[model samples]
Target: MNAPASAIEQLQLGLPELDWITDPNRIQRLSQDFSWFSPVLTRQLEGKVADAVVRPRTEEQIRQVVAACARLKLPLTLRGSGTGNYGQTTPLAGGVVLDMTSFNELLWLRPGLARAQAGIRLNEIEKAAQAEGQELRCMPSTYRSATLGGLFGGGFGGVGSINYGPLAAPGNVVGLKAMTIEPEPQIIELRGAEAMRMHHLWGTNGLVLELEIGLAPAQPWLETLAVFDDFDAALAFADQLARAPGLDKREVAFLASPVPDYLTQLAESLPKGCHAVLSLVAEAGEEALAELVSAHGGRVSYRRTAAEVSKSHKTLMEYTWNHTTLHALRVDKSLTYLQTTFTPGEYVRQITELSRRYAGEVFMHAEFLRNMEGQTNCSALQIVRFTTEERLQQIIDEHRAYGVRINNPHTFIVEDGKAGGDLPEDVLAMKARFDPLGLLNPGKLRGWPVGAAS
Candidate 1:
């Protein structure tokens, strides 16, 4: 690896037209992410940082920069909004950091689909779709700041995931345009299974330029914030509400403890020792939704009309899980999160036991995801707060020993388990075929071409 200053000078001389950042402070800021277990901190402690950072605006510029780096045998890492919880976007080889935010552009929008540049934020795309009476089928909690490319590359389940399914499903993404680094860098367009294979690989196989996604009709939605006296009741009601037929359009199933100040409002409203669940339902009338809640022993603490929701939904992004975690982190800087899947039927009991075991050391926060393959299986995202790094690792170990599968965003990439099994072989094969130089995010992917690292 080259010295940071020397590499920055070399890259500038090679690609003067591309914007380059060499400041040590800025490089330090770019080195880490929201992940609690990021290796960047340790790397920084070792006095190492990315050799250089490049921000390219155009597709040709991106290609040109990659071509140059490939020629120099320098590693490259792609970044979007940097809202990812995993270290997926962190440069491991201390090479070039490619900031893709400047590539923002909306190429096209039809009735059922829309194509956008990799840097476009999810909320930006949603606003455009709303104008056409349509909306994205699903979006992660970080939609406001998260770029489309980042979500496709690193995001897992989100609020709308309960209805439309995970983003990797064939029905969600229509196509993608990506740049490959190999014998010769070239742009290629893929659709169907070929395109879907790249989902959640953390930008290892290729660098995405544009994406086309299927859209859902924009419907009047009701947003409600509710509270319950007991955790079990809240969990039971949430499960019943989520599993009820004809309620496929619930946007979010967020449950949080009373620790955070924001949740303190719910704490004030509910009886002592109460928890809260915030639910957003779309395409349902108020009366029907009210009846469903009433049947499940849920009282609608607060309700917003469709017009209000549409006008404020974007603002609500700040109140979601991602933002909630940011708030919780203020209380405990060593906190880390986990992404796991569980059968909804068994979720309540299992989570309750886990929470009790961790006690004061960890607080459980969860989001309900859509059921897959009619198996009654559901995915839940959990964030664990710890006072010490050792405690964090211990919690992770306990979860694993209990046979709980975890996609630890604090360190490794969080991905769909089913998708992961098939990714390594396919990604390695694709890299061998297209990126034989292994110049693009070399060590990021799980099974990248062996010995291909430059």
Candidate 2:
């Protein structure tokens, strides 16, 4: 059930001192994310919007909003930049959207580590870390506006994942400060593995206030693009770069034929009908990268030094990841996308086979990264030609039959999104302990029904 009308009034009256937004248009916009990427999700969440919004500028203000919402039993959905594509910030039950952007602040930065308020943008943290000769270990393509809490709550690793694996991999996140949802909020600090209990749950388990993340030494990365006439040759080159230990690389993205056609902004570098491999390698690895490209019969079509890239304010990082889907959608509104992970030692073969099996239908777009287990593999964000819901499910089933792991992005429920159908007992226990009333992002967590007691 949605929050009672009387309860919303009570919440507003209780937190009269904090910023409360009741404008319908702004509320509608704040209630949405990039979920429209999926035609399935777009229809499913068509009219879902929060009844009101509250922007808390400080930890104390956040406590007041949380405490009031808890007291009134109002369903509260936490929102950070709203850069996620899975409708993560969209509220299934109308109540209040807690906008965390205004609370942004970088708390501290030291060598190899940084702590910042949950609402701070990832780019801001990276800029601060760079001043200390360090950078974020893993950041999404939307890092320019994506928030720290948003990533920890709803994202997987990106760019730097090839070296450090995913964000969930140990050592990437040092600790975090969260608040328990109660009439009297309790500020709690969790460190090491314990802090991760709230990671990737879409902020349903607890309210993250500030995050402490691990950093990596800064590298002057050279952005380069390799274009090939052969699909097998392109995938092989990217896989080789990902596996090359001597090359200090940050990213290796493979875009199979026609997929590159959608990236109109890079038309000069992306020749028509060519499969592309985009990467960010240290200047020291320039020769090795060129040799590998030549060995695969792929030619370097684009080159930008780290300094040049900084001046242009454009990097190939934006062309990879989900941004590929955005560009594809811009070209064809009927197109959708899928998230799949190929088998570890067999990713290249699987990709080549699938590309052949579904040529002209599922255009290949893969990002190479080490898994949580430190095994290197390529995860695909393949572009799909939309036909019908049944066809989408059929494609998913076929990929599964071929041993590919599908992390379905069309669903909003936490359990349904993961390959696994249920959450861990420990994760549920964290939810029970932190949000007893289930007021935090209520409808998203499958294991714990809204308002169900521990």
Candidate 3:
């Protein structure tokens, strides 16, 4: 529910020059993200809306809104392009949603690094970096619309994660500028690990203003699909490709059997009853990739040269990562997904065993990535045939029993969605220091007591 209209009106009147969206319908629409991806989150976050939205075009304007909200003790939720799936942009406590898209600007670009305002879109940054013969080291599949800040605040890694790991990995995110929640907002500069304290906290710890990120040298990536009749062969090919240090690749995903069938757009390429490994490797490594596919008894079913993909503006990337879930949902509405990490060396065995255990119930879809400790493994975003919430929890528990870590996506509570048990004391302390009154995304961080001050 929205806060009192009078309060929102008062905020608007105070900042008469600021851009405000007061239309209830538009406000409601802007209040939501892709959280509807999960039936559980859909139900829990139902009817949650921000009282109003403010689109600040300048850093000065943002400070004004921040100060006013803090003085009024109003809950504030920071938002970007709203591409997140876990209700990261949803305002659990009705107040103000600070829309940051207008604040976008590519601050500067240097060799192996670039800095940009929090609202800059990932694609925009990539295009700019590409002009400099560099590209983002890691970005989500929704890079075209997802903002740099949105990815930093709520995203793990995607696409290029095989080489760089997640956004939280050391050196990926060099530094950031954040604003504390207070009447007199303090703009702080945090570097290295200090800046990452706010990472993946769902924007509950502090408000990020700008970020400096590392970049990878540009490559002409060849997008292809290696199809195999045998599921084990497909998994092995993807695993080998991920572990092959000599083959330069951006992405490697295994879509087993029925999972490939769900990608209707790629139906022609994804032959019936075949497991597929979608990959993005350097154009120069095409012959090597083909050799590996043949070694594993598979065939290249689809091929799109970098130039063709660039001209057509279509790539297999749109059909991998969480995009796979989206396409599957489009084809079959009765499906949900799980976020899981398998034991590194045992990933293939674990996936093989689980596929047998669940078979038709859980469709195996894995993305090969390097973990924080630089270990090679695959994180599975398995598509499940949703029957009931109880059954979903059971599936998660069973996976945990099999030694796979499940990061529950169904919960809006920051700590609950995480794989680890509870928020670290340092994380809680970060929240207290940056958001003393707990006014920033109030209900999302369960560890903080409401209205508490440092």
**Considering every candidate listed, which one attains the maximal lDDT?**
3
Q: How do the residues 25-141 of candidate 1 rate in per-residue lDDT, one tens digit apiece?
A: 887667556654333234333443578888899998898888877777787878898887666666767788888888999999999999999999998998899999998888877
Residue 23, model 2: lDDT of 86
Residue-level lDDT of model 2, residues 346-396, one tens digit each, is 998899889899988999999999998999988999999999999998998
- In order, candidate lDDTs are 0.69, 0.91, 0.92
Could you tell me how far off, in angstroms, the CA of residue 219 lies in candidate 1 after the best superposition? 1.5
Worst 10 residues of 3 by lDDT: 445-454
TM-score of 2: 0.97
Better model by TM-score: candidate 1 vs candidate 2: 2
Clash pairs, candidate 3, are none
Model 3 C-alpha lDDT per residue in residues 366-449, reported as the tens digit of each score: 999999999999999999999999999999989988788999989888888896577877787888889887889877876654
lDDT of 1 at 166: 77
Backbone clash pairs in model 3 (N, Cα, C under 3 Å; residues 3+ apart or in different chains), count = 0
Q: Which portions of model 1 miss their true places by more than 4 Å?
A: 1-8, 37-48, 254-256, 259-273, 310-317, 374-377, 387-390, 413-423, 446-452
